[model samples]
Target: MSSSELVRVGIQIICEHLIEVLKEELKRSRKNYREDVDVGGLDPLEDPESYRNHLRMSENQFEELYEKVKSKIEKQNTIMREALPSRLKLQITLRYLATGDTYGTLEALYRVPRCSIGRFVPEVCKAIWEVLEEYIKVSRTNLLNNIYLVHSLT
Candidate 1:
């Protein structure tokens, strides 16, 4: 393959690897949901009746993210079919990662255990962080840079 194609392939693999890592990280959390779980209601999306907010650039940005993630998800699904054996596992996991729903709500919405969602979310988030750790780290350099910038502006 060409260098550009290799880069594209590497990016694709990184995304798939990120999702897998996130799922594994989610598995390491030990929290369980009890009947008294105290999650609040949804902070509703700010789209208005007249669709003004929907017309914003953020919507298009989100749409692009959705497409990229969805394609990566599809590729991962094919690779994982033999191992996972259940088609819904990935979809449910993605929903848990993308949407900050409580275990109870996810259970009701996706027919999975509240305990499962509670246990899974952090794992996935950790995995994503792990994949991008070098790039995403809150480094001393970044903090110092930000501090300097703030002081200069003030």
Candidate 2:
């Protein structure tokens, strides 16, 4: 090749190599996110006493309810990350209901963002209500039937 042609090809090769190196550096920098927010540590529901105190439900009840509603409440895991566990979401919702605490209080305890807790509370409650609706309706029907039976006999 001519001298000028060779120099042009070398510069082009160097530019391509530099672009690849820059892309890799970008990937590394993205992975090294400087997250200051505390997150995902020490679930209170793991302890039986704390579970009952905070949720007003036994662990078994929590598990049963969680199982029923898990599919409804679960979120899709993306390239970003997996969503919070269904158990934790339910615990947060129950704690809010029991104590009427603000999202700030829940955020401190759960290590989730107050904004996220605000979104999660209503979504989780709706999931729980959807799962429990049948049982609630059945109980109401049984109670009304007993009342009708008593009145009819009189």
- For lDDT, the strongest prediction is 2
lDDT of 2: 0.71
TM-score per candidate, in order?
0.30, 0.67
Q: Write the per-residue lDDT of candidate 1 for residues 40-96, one digit (tens) a residue.
A: 222116543322232223544434433444433332323222212122333444454
Model 2: number of clashes? 0
Which regions of candidate 1 deviate over 4 angstroms?
A: 1-94, 137-154
lDDT of 2 by residue, 30-64 (tens): 55543443465335447878767777888788778
Question: lDDT of each model, Cα atoms only?
Answer: 0.46, 0.71
Error of 2 at 73 (Å): 1.1
Model 1 TM-score, 2 decimals: 0.30
